[model samples]
Target: MLNTHLIMEQIRYHPIVATISIAVGTVLASEVIWKVVQYFRSKREKANRVHEVVVFNELGEICAAQHLWNTRPGSQEPEAAHCRNTHCTLRNVGKIAEQIDRAVYSIDLAIYTFTSFSLADALKRALQRDVSIRIISDGEMVFSSGSQITMLARLGVPVRVPITTYMMHNKFCIIDGVERVEEIRQLRKRKWMRPCYSIAVSGSVNWTRQGLGGNWENCIITADEKLTAMFQAEFNRMWKAFEKTEASLIQPK
Candidate 1:
């Protein structure tokens, strides 16, 4: 009987140790759960940063479209599969002009060489619609067979080209002027309210038909606001500079 009583006492004391072990285990488990929650929260925040808000229907459905490009057949071979395909992001000048409505308030371009009749036609259409147009290109492009500048001027498009010593090596366009205006004002009130996203179209093709549809060129469309701002500033600066200068009128070729 005495031995049995002593064994019971030991067993009773063991309960306290068991309780402590359980308590420690619960604390460890809670810590692990806390860490897991933190990891998920961080992931969600990062995802939000990269995601874009897109409107589908009248309701808001957030979506992200990364900058991508595609090339037409037979001009230059692509570096990889992503470099050439419909899945890539690209819009011809014609497509871009078609996309513009309401007001094609501004067109900022810095092409090294442009001789595309299709592209010229697109610009002309945009001007006829009373959409404000602006163009700035190097002197090399001024020699196109078709008098693009004169035609644009006849249609009242604001064309500006600088006679700087350095090459005007920019090749990009912004279709909407509202966003450019908003960005320039540094007005945060409309920061979230952007005009339809602008695309950056580029490729091996010049404005010539051979370059636009004939040659394979890589271009990407992005809703990237930062790139938009940069291009806007560049265009505005060049426009202002050219605005200060007196330009000799070119006779229609």
Candidate 2:
């Protein structure tokens, strides 16, 4: 307490000491501020990367993909045995249609928004090959502008919509193939082709152009028989609610 005079004398003469003290204080403050900013930035980035369930209220201008939703930006199509968790981009969307194109006995599917012409074309080919097919979509979005639901309905593929106060936000497709060699031969004899395997796909992705070609989406495809059957059963149950013979020009025998 009695050294005030001495302390003042030392600080006044050692100006370099004062400068160094000020510089160290500034660096420490800057470091703290940088750390705080980095913490917040990391939180914001993680939130942005996380996918949340979106409740689509109305159909916007349906167009090509303008956003990306892949967790891995440049990942490739999943390998066969490993496709159980396959994530897909816009270009990989055609594979879904291709799977439908390969359907042997039937293609049962439901989607929230049906806007992919490529998928509609695949269904068209399935119909031409006499494959039993049914589609269910959201009552609101299915009839909206640019949705290919009408195109599919006009082409005589069975299409149904559940009238609900809430959104029928579901998307899945199951491809049923011949389970037996005799069934495969029987279909082949009729000029119909069956995929060597059966598959079912389900995920956050819709069949819309925005879902596949523009927005962030993810889906998993599997050859698991039990899983495929479960999905098929769900489709059949939903199909009955709005089924009509006029829904298909070619009645399923």
Q: Could you say which candidate leads in lDDT?
A: 2
TM-score of each: 0.51, 0.55
lDDT of 1 by residue, 7-102 (tens): 567558897775776689899999999999989987774443321221112111111122212334564322223322332222334244444432
Give me the candidate number with maximum TM-score: 2
Model 2 alpha-carbon drift over 4 Å, by segment: 1-90, 177-196, 243-253
lDDT of each: 0.53, 0.65
Which residue window of length 10 is worst by lDDT in model 2? 55-64
Q: Whole-model lDDT, candidate 2? A: 0.65
lDDT (tens digit, per residue) of candidate 2 on 131-233: 7776788777877888776777666666777766878798888777333323446856865553345678788888776676456666777767677777877
RMSD of 2: 20.9
